[model samples]
Each structure stands twice: as C-alpha cells, then as structure tokens.
Target: MKDYMGYSIEGRTTAISTILNQYSSGITLMKQDSNGEFYPLKAKTTILPNGSKSYILTPCNQ
Candidate 1:
C-alpha cells in the first residue's frame, strides 16, 4: 500500500483488484461518521458483463 501524507492513495496504476481479492481477509474497510469517527465498511461485489467487478460499499449505520 502507498500512502501520501498519512492517507492511503489509490491510483490507476495500483493493483487494488488483486489485493482486494487475494488478501481481503486482512483488510478491514472503514467509513467515517458524522461524529468524526471511523467504522467498518460493509460492501458487496457484483460481476459485470465485461468480466469486471463492481463494489457497493454500504453506508455505516452510526
């Protein structure tokens, strides 16, 4: 993973797909809340017709 000033940077050249697929168990997706706190990010992936995948990250309840 690459970081720019304490933030994870995702770019076109980054191989995120492989990382998300192969090492997803180690990754805990997160989201920020209105109170300025972070929580786990729930998501689901769907396969497209072109053999590509799309992720739908569900909103945090709190």
Candidate 2:
C-alpha cells in the first residue's frame, strides 16, 4: 500500500459500492471511462478551491 495526502492507497481493485459505504460523508466519488473522462458517481461532494465540485481525471501512464 502507498500513502497519498494522509490517505492509504491499497493498490487493489474493489467494488464502487464498497468505496461509497466507507466514505459516506464529505466525499465526492468519480469513475474513469474508456475515453479517459471522469464522471461523478455519488451526489455527496466537496467544493474545490476553484468552486467546482468535480475535477479532471489525470491517468498515470506508468
């Protein structure tokens, strides 16, 4: 596992429902598509500094 901004990265795949249940509050969930675009999954979200509720998904090609 790795650490990212105080959050632990398990580096494993899991169901989306499991993630939503774990972070049931104050969190915005997004999923990536085959076209490299991201869409919101959950309604509960946090407003970013730019006043946007969602962000662009940047994929790591490593």
Candidate achieving the largest TM-score: 1
Clashes of each: 0, 0
Give the lowest summed-lDDT range of ten residues in model 2.
Answer: 1-10
Off by over 4 Å in 1: 1-25, 60-62
lDDT of 2 by residue, 1-62 (tens): 11212232322222332344456765555667899887655322356898865322223331
**Candidate 1 residue pairs in clash (backbone atoms < 3 Å):** none
| lDDT string, candidate 1, 1-62, tens digits | 33411233333113343345456667655656889988765544678899976554444463
With a 3 Å backbone cut-off (N, CA, C), the pairs that clash in candidate 2 are: none
lDDT of 1 at 57: 47
